[model samples]
Target: MLYGSTYPRDIFAELNRLQRELEQSFDIEPSIRGIGRGGFPALNVGSTPQSVELYAFAPGLDPAKIEVNLERGVLTIAGERTDQPGTPAQQATVHLNERFHGRFKRVVSLPDDVDPDGVSAVYQNGVLHISVRRQQAAQPRRIDVH
Candidate 1:
């Protein structure tokens, strides 16, 4: 008589092998917050009763290079980091390089009550501060019965 393999043995072995491979290759992608070209800078956002504030720590950039736009209850900040601070030779010896340099854009969703018309931004001391006033219609009002 001819010798042959059993039914359950081959199937079980194959399934086990596949499980092992999947477990070995299992990896999770890192979650990125905010928007940017490569490495995004940290942003601090705060909201008050009458306005919303946003601060971004962006050094080596000018006020002209940055552009702010608000549309459809969304705020977008886009700018390019030009390498004009140091000489080419000086930049070659950077030890701990943590600064981000490139074209970057960050978009934030504004609240329905925010007034897009009264948005403003200012850059100072390597920080960009933005203030958005809330619309009058969105403010809570007390009503009295006549």
Candidate 2:
């Protein structure tokens, strides 16, 4: 129960708890695509005066499978990561698997100054690096005071 004025009344809280219990009791099966958490590639995004750069740390993914798109002030990366090669029977117990797998799509809203046509992408050493240059007019200009 939350403290302060934010907490709901005791009766309301009890009713909410009962609702959750009833939902769990139903035990509805989940869809195949909704079975687990979808993949979300970790990224390091930064920008300079001239360009915006984004680097996604995605190992074990083929560079050819990756796709990047910039449109309407949005940058999107969508792709699928193939499964590891090996006989499933040969593998014993699994432990500590934190890496993301399956389909991944990340959309980032770009600044108004970013030039969509000037976007470039490079995949190397399991890292996807993207650079988008700023428009000529969008760059800072120095003015002379006479």
Candidate 3:
């Protein structure tokens, strides 16, 4: 390793960190169907002229177990993913374990245009979908050419 040289891995890590920070700080992702704040149960956000929608993926859990809350313009999704039936015995050897089971949380800062009072959440097929209407002032309108 050269004294003044930087490794490629270091550069990639730094870039990823900066991108994550931008996404969190601005509450905007590269795309609506893109990965969100690094955490369990990733989400995708999309916006239309009338409202903004959020989709959170959390499979294999009952809807009743998931908690959704909005406070001070921030949306929070929290819950736990527990081991299911036919669980492996304690003495069983595990070759690969990719599932995440336990408590998880994700706080998404809502855009200023969203109306907190108009927010609604619905969980179906292991996905929690939420929608918040845009304020009248924030909606885009076409103006007549004068």
* Candidate 2, backbone clash total: 0
lDDT of each: 0.69, 0.68, 0.71
- Which candidate number has the best lDDT? 3
Over 4 Å off in model 1, which ranges?
A: 1-39, 85-96, 138-146
Residue 68 miss distance in model 3 (angstroms)? 0.9
Tens digits of per-residue lDDT, candidate 3, 23-139, equal: 545755333222344456778888997898999988887788888888888888877677776665244665434455656677788888888899888988878899989888845
Local accuracy of candidate 2 as per-residue lDDT tens digits, 1-146: 23244434476444533443343357422222221223256677899989999988788888888989998998888777755767342376443233444565677788999987898899888889999999977458899999
* True lDDT of residue 113, candidate 3: 81
Which tens-of-lDDT digit does each residue in 1-45 have in candidate 1?
A: 143334444554455334433433463211223343222445788
TM-score, ranked from best to worst: 3, 2, 1
* Native-referenced Cα lDDT, model 1: 0.69
Q: Write down the RMSD of all candidates, one decimal each.
A: 16.1, 11.2, 10.6
Q: After superposition, how far is residue 3 of candidate 2 from its true place, in Å?
A: 36
Model 3: residue 54 alpha-carbon error in angstroms: 0.6
